[model samples]
Target chain A: MNGAEKIRVENLTKFFINGKTAVSALENVNLTVNDGEFLCVVGPSGCGKTTMLRILAGLEKPTSGRVHINAKAAGVPSTAVVFQGDSIFPWMRVVENVEYGLKLRGVPLKERRAVAMEHLKKMGLERFAYLYPYQLSGGMKQRVNVARAFACDPEILLMDEPFGALDEQNRLLLQQELLRIWEENCKTTVFITHSIDEALLLGDKILVMTAQPGKVKALLDVKIPRPRDIILIKSSPVFIELYKEIWDLLKEEVLKARNIK
Target chain B: MNTTEERLSQNRASLGKEFWLKTFSFLSPLFLLFLWEALAALKLVDVRLFSSPSRIFKTLIPLVLSGELIYHTLISTMRIALGFLAGAIPGVALGLSMGLFPSVRALLMPLVAVTFPIPKLAIMPLILIVFGLGESSKIFTIAIGVFYLVLINTMAGVLNIDPIYIDVAKSFKASRIQFYTTVAFPGALPMIFAGLKLGMGTALLLIVAAELSAAKAGVGWMIWRAYDMFDIERMFCSLIVLAFLGFVFSYLLDFLEKIVIPWKKR
Candidate 1:
């Protein structure tokens, strides 16, 4: 399991019909992420970055080609997704929402609660154990969202711009928190973000993607060491180089995305 | 513009408003009862036609001690419970199926439209003719009356469940049973309970009308028998029993709603 290729997408294409006209969303997109690797996918808005993430999570289907996990079909999933919004069930309290997957799996109540509480503690949300999603702050809700995916102990975690909605300070804090958890868990994770600094700060490899009819434009591997600190990494030359290179690759796509094409 | 102490005092006043609102609600009925009693004592109103609270209370003790009130109340309750079970369970199941499948809706809509407008109680005479003047006829009429109300509410509830929730459940590979039980049932419960509460009231009314035709038991029968004997006090006592039963029914449903949907609780 340690050396296995966690996910493989081969020649994937997606088409959308807006009224009577058809538009290609992604074309001939192929990629693979190895086990325990943290890959960040960056692309212009509507570039199918989120679509690709949804595909990996089994929330959407490609118009053509195949997605495979460990040489098996990926139409269903052995993955869990942390959506862009908090997406916590308002009807469920913090601990109950976190334990949802476990509940579905028929994990016994006492044990499931213990495991849910453990994840909540990791997310610094034990104090809000019994609080409903509506009662939590935006940052706290996202924390619960992340904790929910992790609590399920999924082999592959798909995150679609999980911090895109947060304020800068909170985003940075959560980014560091994400890095800390990812380092400890070492699960295969594919994260979607528009933030170059975020990709640099957290990703072992960054996938830069182009706008509409999305294709992998560039893949940059970060040679940074593990247990990286946010303050230290921001100050490092290596981090700055990777950030600039990715930004340089992304600038044109960003322009095209904003309709300066 | 106000100081902290003034703000605190204002907050206290607002809290007092909610407390007073509840107090007013509880006291309003008692006040109405007091006024009625006063009017009767002063001979401002005919006491025989509009029985005062004291007279009604005096009438209630003997009816209870004689065990006649309890017997009538039990018979009425049993009929309602049986009728509700007969109607609502199948009605909801059928409604949900229709709601989820467009084809079912298309096929069933014509029949439902044709029959839904027809007052179910209007068929009571036909039911009585076929089933005879027994408990079965009354129960059957009550069931038919309640069924359509539950069906429409359940169908609407199922159709109106937040689509995003269904999408979420599907994305997680929820089994069909899981989808219905977790998503459909709980999502539709508030509406289903809404239907049931209305159905209970309708069933009670229909029970009285059914009893008026010819029946020997139930609160409705008791009321009609007392009317025939010109026992106004007994009639008032039966009406009081009916009111109490309706109150209890509504309160029980509300309590269950709060328990099941604790999300509504503060």
Candidate 2:
């Protein structure tokens, strides 16, 4: 189950046209995620982590390099991206936001509502299903966003610092909710984050990346057991060991990001 | 408890604030009418030329009872409604496409920019000549004015939508029809309502201008006819009715806006 590769990226390079200069965002980046595995990526600021995810989500085109998602079967969506900040449509109710992908896929209205309501329940947002995004708090809005991604039930979930903007308590609650959902329904997920602790907590394997013109630095197997106790796991020796290893791999890139080294 | 006392006091404060607001609103018009009545009673202004609030009220009653006021008001109202719908529907369609697709914008923007600024009143003579001095001509002129206001505003509304919404729709693989129905239409609704209000205002303005120039029966024509017969009080009566109509139309639009955009700030 673990070794079956669900996604493969080979020498992924991406460039942006910045007026006169062809600015490179990602340089010869290569990575893979096995089926039902959680891969967390840590990188410095402006490191094109989002660009890589956008490419994976097919929202962007790479300058060169191939990205292949091994779709297990026809009719299952290849990817559904959980964007960084508040991405829920303000005009839509919470249920509508969660049902957006299903609606786009032309699912029947009744089925869409049922599926969305189930996902909202998972996020502890069933009570607010009929409310608009504007009526919700920042943390609640992010949960709606996550619920929408989960409702899509795509082949792979591509999250780009989904909890980066949340306060600590809300972040932990959401991480715990995410773990429960993933445990119930195993999904191939590639999550990007700035926090080493988040990477240590959620990832089956951690992908440490470089600064600008992002390149893969290291890919370390987490070996942390299932059902991670998000709070208590911090005190565990193995979790602390993995945390130091990731920080060491990420520290030089952080310095390079600030141009201090 | 102190909490209950605080809540009670808060409610009382809000109620007191509302009471003062209503009182001030009531007093402003009454104060203006009193000042005008004083000026006229003291004979500072010619009574024949400057009709006082009392004189206008006297004029208003007979015209209203005779059904002349209601007839002209309804005629003008019907024209505004027709012209507004005719212009706004197509304006929304074109504006929506122009906002969503750059090609449509490129093809039509030059035409819009050039024609939008040319005064609608200036084009009245042309419209009258082309459509013939009929109800259609007046309606046509009014529609032209409303079209530009709604189209430009609706287009801006669509363009101003946060790009994150667009990205969200795209990531979900929304079809073209879905994008328009869900993303573009609902997202731009606030601006569309703004455009509709502006369009309605222009509709009112253009209809009066059209009627004054060429009509035999509407409030604008009534004002013109009163001026011809030297019926000073009657002219004032028509002006008051026109002001009321404008207020009613604006108020109706405000009420509609609240219903449509429920997610807006309270």
Candidate 3:
């Protein structure tokens, strides 16, 4: 918790214009993420968690206010995002996908290949290095996506429910895999998810957001110890209490969103 | 163990079916040839008007032996290759520019829309006048036809690429050249191949039309000359040669597609 401030979002707001109507996706979102912290934002389906992550990733500009990354130097990218769906390039094999970031950074082929192979190995994807994305299962493809993000070695990792599309079993497996990788890399991560248990399992601190014109509803620091087993954490009393508290905050937003729909 | 055996037997059965399918496909064409021969032998069709496959082959063999067939084929092939290159290269370049830059699209899209639907053959007279009654005219006719086909398809290919891929590339901070080579070009390849396949067909069709209208030598010219002399067998030979060339060109494109876009196959 004593780590230096790695990212700051101040009075950040986003408005999407459709014809004459403007839809507020996020409103006055303000937060600070410490270096190497794994922060999860949990909210209802339309709570603009993705828009927040996109702003952090620099894919979307805030209508007002600013996001500041404490970059070590100028002209260096400080963030990478793992999108919600299958964002792995189907035309590329596993190795190529992992090497894409390094290649863009003008890394030599030999060096990039070694780095990519190392990440693929860590993801247990060494054997499928030459295989195309379409040949893999949803779980395996998500693994590739994670490997690609981590291999980039960005200053911060912005993940928008990377495992949201998978079935429950695959989602749990990837969540564990993600935790293991994050534990090793310790990158400043802002992960957005709909699952309360997932937010509790992986995040150092959890931020729950309100529905539609989303605003931060609650921010709770998860006191769960490090090197935690996700399954074991689920059965713990403290885990259940935090889950219940976050669920209670989120349930109201979910209902409000549903009523609007 | 039972499931494994079942799967093995299923594989064998499919293999057997595939073998029979291949045999039937080969036999079907041979059967048509035999039927044609039978009809011609029994004089069921007038030999003068409808030459038998055998008489066509007899005329084809002598022409091929005398190198006349090769000469015409080479001339036609050269025109097609040169014209396809001239049109396809510029077409892809312009298409990429149009797809990438809104200004280019706005400027040229109207011109493309107007001319693309006008059949290339209809403008043969204009092309002939502009390039003169020679190889230039023939090549120009084919090039113009191929250009439109390639340009339209390439533009669509670039436009149709999933914007998500572009976002990924942008996130990686890929340079413009890298964006095209690694993302846009490869991403648009399947569609581009579709365009190239279409362009190849148009090239063959336009070349034949061009040769028919104005050319000293080509399969089309030979066919035209044979018709004028009332040589049915020679005309049939030329038609058969043209058919073979079309098949070869299409097959070559398929082979190239397989090579360039290997990721398409599982």
For each candidate, the DockQ is 0.31, 0.77, 0.69
Model 1: per-residue lDDT, tens digit, A109-177? Answer: 999999999999988899999988778889999999899889878878888899999998999889988
Model 3 lDDT on a 0 to 1 scale: 0.89
Q: Residue B76 of candidate 2: its Cα lDDT?
A: 90
Q: How far off is model 3, as Cα RMSD?
A: 1.9
Q: Arrange candidates by DockQ, descending.
A: 2, 3, 1
Each candidate structure's count of clashing pairs: 0, 0, 0
lDDT of 1: 0.85
Candidate 3: clashing residue pairs, number:
0
Per-candidate Cα lDDT values, in order, are 0.85, 0.90, 0.89
Clashing pairs in 3: none
Per-residue alpha-carbon lDDT of model 2 for B1-266, expressed as tens digits? Answer: 57988999999999999999999999999999999999999998888898798998998898999998999999998888889888999998899999989999999999999988998899888888899988898888878888888899899999999988888888888888989999899988999888999888888777778898778899988988998998898899888888898899999989988888887766
Say which candidate scores most in DockQ. Answer: 2
Q: List candidate 2 segments past 4 Å from native.
A: B1-14
